[model samples]
Target: MDEIIRAAGALLGQSLRYPVDLGGSSRSTVLRCRTATGGSVIVKAFADDPEARRAYTGETAGLSLGLAGPELLAADIERRLLVMADLGDVPTLADLLLGTDPKAAERGLLEWARGLGRLAACSVQRRAEFAALWQHHGQGLPSWEDEPWQRQNVDAFLDLLTECGLTAPPGLADELTAVGTAGGERYPGFTPGDTCPDNNLITPEGLRLIDFEAAGYQSVFLTAAYCRMPFSSCWCVYQLPADLAQRIEECYQFEVVTQYPDLAEEELWQAGMAQAVVVWTVDTTLRLLRRALPQDGRMHRTRRPVPTRRQVLRHRWTSALQLTGYPAFTSTMRLLLSELAAGWDVPELPGYPAFRAGAGPEAVQTVNSRGPETAGG
Candidate 1:
């Protein structure tokens, strides 16, 4: 540890004080540190992997826009070390949303919208250099939505919705995909793909955006969709008044309509719903995979237990059956969920046991002993 600190000090040309690990991707280590003069900074150091190095550098350059952050104190391209200003006293938008007051959430949401609007409106004319960097550097990384596991992953997400007693319309995933793909191809604007509440910091000066790792030029509709999911979830989970969430959505829509007059309100709202499904689906898949594959390392660290295949199947079956009498092609997401349920409800998928109303321990034994099979091919 001492040797690593010494090496970093040599590169930074300052007397480094302490390093506080801020947990993040497996590919990199993030540390919050303070200098001798009591100035705080964040240092992001990448693993030896070249791809991680490229991504780190790309974000640093691409995100160097109108907003202020910790100054880049030092950077060594070869060592993959970056030291930047740390804005203290400011809390993440997540923190603000967690407050008990609805007004607080609304204020935070408005601040976030204003900040993003300023960024979206900034001149891309001078940003050509960073734009080019993004185009070249971000080519091969995975799209969060297009992962191979997605087709088989709906059951896990459906379990949570069922547990919460919320039954969505059927065939939701395909509808969401169609919506996003269409808007992605047609909409005009910039999008930062991962704009969850954690990425925003509400400072006294204004809303300051952080983390440009996944940002890029995208459709205005897509951009709005990207921002809404996490912001909405923050409000929902934190118990912020429902009205505040509506207001936040309104503020966001206002910005979008102001900048892109051609946007249709109905289509934008549909796109937002699609975006929400995408986020929820991915989250649910990981939850299920952890349960079915308990030996997998990622599952061990999470806070919640993975849902058994039987439990998920049961939840999805109940939800899909509820949508049975509804008209065809109603809600896109609902339709997709129904379709997935049809596949998942097959008499037997490799790892899934036969569903019985009263069986618990017996079902676990049956599924685990059955081994892995393509549950829905």
Candidate 2:
């Protein structure tokens, strides 16, 4: 700990004090420290390992771009540490959704979508610059763009289906090749990869994203999927009010359409979104299937109203079933539901706590009694 403090203090040329541990995953240690000038800074020291080094590289490159996020104060490659301006004590989107303020949560969700869409639009042309920066910072590691995780997930899930005694659906092809990735050279834009709810801070300045370890550019539909599928890769999963969810999706689409005008076509945009949704659902299932099927677990350790794993996956499969164009993928999701989720003994996923509360902003926009279909992602 002292070594990390010294490294961060050296990089910033200051005496650091009052360090408070901000929770991080196994990959890194995050600290909030007060500078000699009485302001605070965030110091993140990566673990001494290859995966951590790659994460450090991605975050460093993304922050160095200065497109958005906290200002990168300083960095030291040798120590694998970064010092960034602290955004401070702001409520994250997760906080709002978990709290009892539906209006606030709805507003935060829309703002977050708009911010990410605008960021993607503005950074659409920076792929080369990002690649260069990534290369410079990450000499030996692959960027998220070059990672084979997508294809790996596709294969792994097929194996998982076989293990479950379920065969791949025979819709698009016997080989099931159509159920691959939604990515193409078109509509590529920047994303932080893990745009989960907890990582987004809903500050007074607006929505500020954090944790750029998986940062790279990809199809904008992936980002749109997060809004439409509603935090596609997050543990903080629940249903959004139907109207609010549509508004959130529209807010993102409206911003991105400025950069990629073709997305203004409802059919094209919706189709792309459906493809991305299926891709994300497959990736998520591959990762969580073994763990969830054995037994259900809470999505968050301490958060209330959190759904169980089986519930979340069931919700995702249900949403994927509604997607129009992907017959094979839809069939796969249905089989998973009937064969696996049917015996989980869990009810359908419920709406977000804020939106479901009896009082707070309940039904701000009227809709039929049926709320949003549960999200599986």
Candidate 3:
């Protein structure tokens, strides 16, 4: 901590004190520090590792674009340290959803989608610029675009299926190859990377995106999947009322349609979105299946009132079945559902806490009857 603080202080020409450790993952250490001028700044120092260096590159490059996130105050590339303007103690979207107010949660969802879409639409033309910036800040490492992440995920999932005594559906590979093409390529857009519930601040001004550690250009459909799956990679996963979810999806769709009018086409939009969802579903299982198979645990380490791994997987499988045109992927999901999830004896995922039946005064209408919540232990 002292080492990072001294490096940051040197870059800013001032001493930073009273560090409040804002828990960062293995890749970095984040602190809210009091500057000499009585102001505050966020100081993040990356670990001396490739993963951390890459994250530093992405964040510095992303924020440098002035696309979104807090202002970059100072940086020391050699030290992999960043001093950014403090966003202060604002409540995040997670706070709203986990709280008792349904109205605030619903509002935040719609606005969050809209803000993200606008960010994507405006960034469509800056791909080359982003690539150049990435190259500049990156430690000569391959960018997300160069990495075959989806293919790797597919391969990993296939291996996982074999371990679980399951077989891939016959057409799954062909189907994934088909729809998966040109997701980001067709309608590429910039995003803060990890737009998870806890990563964004919902301030009085509006949604302030934080954590560009995963920042880069990718498929707009990937972002869309976040809404459809009700947050694809986040720990705040829970069932949103179908109607509300659709409204949130539409909110994003309308914004992006302004940039890529073709997204307005039902067939193209459906196909791309379905593909992104399929890949993400594979990703979710690949990430959680083995761990979940052993024992159910909270999705987050410290966040309270979070859903369990089994609940999230069950929800992922059930919702994935609603998607069509990926018959093999669909079958794969079914196999996981019957073979693995069945043995777990976990209940189907329930609605967002704010929208659950009989939620307090601010609750909206009941979730459009999705049958008796899957009964289980």
TM-score for each of the candidates: 0.61, 0.92, 0.93
In candidate 3, residue 127 scores what lDDT? 83
lDDT of 2 at 156: 77
Q: Give the TM-score of candidate 2.
A: 0.92
Which lDDT tens digits does candidate 3 get at residues 151-267?
A: 677668778889998888797777766655338777889988888877767888888888898788889999988888888887778889899999999999999999999999999
lDDT of 1 by residue, 1-377 (tens): 35445556777777676877665465676667777677767777767665575556555655554343445566666566667777664566554443334455567777777556545545333346555554444434443323323344455455545554546556654543343433443444444444555567777787766555544554444455434333321111212234544565566666666555555467655644454435443443344433433222221132111223433433332423333222322343354345444444323212211122232332111111211111120
Candidate of highest lDDT: 3
Order of the predicted models by TM-score, top scorer first = 3, 2, 1
- lDDT tens string, model 2, 280-376? 8877787667778778887765455578888888999998889776778788888999998888899888888787758453222211111112223
Single out the weakest 10-residue window by summed lDDT for candidate 3: 368-377
Each candidate's lDDT (Cα)?
A: 0.47, 0.80, 0.81
Off by over 4 Å in 2: 171-176, 359-377
Candidate 1 error regions (>4 Å):
1-4, 66-70, 123-127, 135-177, 180-182, 226-240, 264-377
lDDT of 1: 0.47
User: 338 in model 1: Cα distance from truth in Å?
Assistant: 8.0
lDDT of 2 at 107: 88
